[model samples]
Target: MKPRTILLSLMSYLAVTATAIAAPEYSVDHGSYNFGTVTQGKKVQHSFTIKNNGDATLQIKQLTASCGCTAATPSASSIAPGKSAEIKVVFDSTNFSGKVQKTVAMTTNAGKNPNYTFTMEGIVAEELQATPRQISLGTMKAGVPREVTVTVRNNGSTMHRLISATANSNSLQITPKIPKQNIKPGESGTVELTIASRSEARILSGYLHIVTDNPQKKEITIPIYGSAAK
Candidate 1:
C-alpha cells in the first residue's frame, strides 16, 4: 500500500473512535429499591438518580411505568454531560395485597445504552384477609346451583363491622353467615356464595365485593371462576 493511503486510513479510524467515545452514556445510581412493608390503600414513592457519563448531552425520550397503579416522572427532559437528574416512581397499593414488585423504564438518546429500567418492591398489609382469595366452582351443569364458602378474617387490631356483601353478576348470590354484624379483632367469619347458570352453557366469571368497616381495606374482592356445561 502507498504511504499516503495508509496515513489517510489511520486518520479516518481515529475520527470514528473519537465520535463513538463522545456519545452520550447513562448510569443509574441504583437499579432496584425495596420499600419493605406498606399498608394497603396508600401510595409510595421513590427517586432514582441518573448520571450522564459521556461527553455528549443525554436526552430522555420517554418514561413509562409497568401498570396503571404505577407512575414515573423525570426531573428534566435532558441532562448536560457529566450532570445528573432524578426519576421519581410512585406505586399505588389500593388494589394490591401481599408481595408486589413494580418497574419503571426509561428511553434515552444514549447510543450504546438507550434503555434503562428501575424496580421497586414491597409487601402490602391489609386490615382484612380472605382465604383462597379466589373461588373456582370447576365444571357445573347448566341450571344447577353450586355453593362455596369463603372465610373472612380480621387481621387488624381493632374490631370491624361487615357492612355488606355484593356480587357483580345477577346469576350469583352472596350471604354473610356471621351471627353479628360486628366482628372482634382477630376473629373470622364465613361468606356463602351461590352461583348458578341458566339455560345456556358458557364461562362464568365475576367478582364478589365485600364492604367492611376497615379503613384501609374497605372493599375486598373475591374472584369467582367456573364453566357451565351443557
Candidate 2:
C-alpha cells in the first residue's frame, strides 16, 4: 500500500471518532417513579435528575405531559457537559381513582435517542369507597328478579351522601326508589341494586351510576355483570 493512501485513511478515521465524541448525550438518573398510594384530591411531586454525559451541552427543547392532571418543568433548559439538572413533575389526583399511570415526555438535542418518556404510577384512594367496587347479579331465570347490595363507606372527614342511583340498562333497577342515604364520617351505608330481569334472556352488562355528595367524586360507577338463562 502507498504511504499517501494509508495517511488519508488514518485521517478519515480520526475525523469520525472526533465527531462522535463531540456530540451531546442525554442521560436520566431515574426515568420511572412509583408513588404507592395517595388519597383522592391530593397532589404528589417528584424530581428527576438529568445529566449531560457528552462533551457538548445538552439542550432541552420541549417538555410535555400525557394528561392535564400532570405538570412537568425543568430547572434549566440547557445542561453543560457532565453537569446535572432537575426535572420536577407533579400529579394531581383529584380526577383520578384506583390504579393510574401518567407520563411526561422530554425532547432534547442529543446526538442519539433525543426523545424520552418518564412514567409515574400509583393508586388513588377514594373518600367514599364501595365494598365490592363491582356487583355480579349472578345467573337467574329469565323474568326472575335478583337483588345485590353494595356497602358504601365514608373514609374521609365529611358527610357522604348518596344523592341518586341510576341504572344504565332496563334489566336492572335501584330499589328503595330514590336511594337517598347519608353516611356519616367514618361510617357506612347500604345501597340496594335489583335486577328487574328482562323477558328475553341474554347477557346483562352495564354500570350502576351513583351520584354522591362528596366533592372529590361527584359521580361513581359500579360495574354490573350477569346473565339470565332462558
Candidate 3:
C-alpha cells in the first residue's frame, strides 16, 4: 500500500474512535424546582423531564431521595435517543416546618457521568412552632441534674392552649413557667425540663410529649438523649 493511503486510513480510524467515545449523553430540562411556600401537613409534587440527547439509549438504574419524607419515581426505565421522560418527585410536608431543601439522585448508564442529582426547596408554614425541635442534654454527670428549656409559640390568629406536658422517664421533670395557661395569638412560652441519670456510667434516652390545641399537630414528641459519665 502507498504511504499516503495508509496515513488517510489512520486519520479515518482516529475520527471514528473519538465519535464512539462520546456516544451516550444525559440531560435534564431543569436542575432544580422551588415550591415557594407550602402548608404544613400537606404533600407537594413536581415533575422533572430527563432527555437523552446522545446517539445511544439511556437507562436509569436507580432512583433515590435524601430522606423518607421525599420520594422520586421515573416514568420509564429506559429512554431512546432524542427522547425524553418525566421523573416525578413528591415531598411530604407532614411534621416539617420552616425552610427545607431535599435532593433526588438518579443513577444512569451514561458513561463517565453515571449519577445525576436535582434539588427541591420550599418553606413550610405552621400554625404552631417549636424552637430547637430536638433537645440535646450533652454529657452529664451521674446524680447531677441537667436543666434545659424549650419554647413553644403560637403563630396563628386564634388562641391555643398547652393541654399537658409529660416525659416518658420518671427521672425527667417538666415545669411550665408561662404567665397564662392559654397561649394567645403570636404569644410564646417556655417549658423547663430537668433530667438526671441514676447509674454512674450509662446512656439515658427518653421522649418528652407536649400536647397542644393545634388540630394538625395536637401532640409532638421531642427526643431526649444524654450520656452519664463518672
Q: Give all TM-scores, in the order shown.
A: 0.68, 0.73, 0.61
Cα lDDT tens digits, model 2, 27-140, are 898799999998899899999999999899899999999999999999999999999999999999998789999999999999888999999999998888887888777776
Flag regions of model 1 displaced more than 4 Å. 1-21, 135-149, 156-159, 166-175, 183-209, 215-217, 221-230
Whole-model alpha-carbon lDDT for candidate 1: 0.83
Whole-model Cα lDDT of every candidate shown, in order? 0.83, 0.85, 0.81
| Highest-scoring model, TM-score | 2
Candidate 3 C-alpha lDDT tens digits along 1-230: 99999999999999999878766678888879999987677788999999998888899999999999999999999899899999999999887888999999999989868899989998998767777688777777776777788788887778888787778854444343434458888888666776776653467677888888788889868888767665
Q: Which one wins by TM-score: 1 or 2?
A: 2
Give the clashing pairs for model 2.
none
| Weakest 10 consecutive residues of candidate 2 by summed lDDT | 171-180
What stretches of model 3 exceed 4 Å from their correct place? 1-22, 131-162, 166-208, 213-216, 221-230
Better of 2 and 3 by TM-score: 2
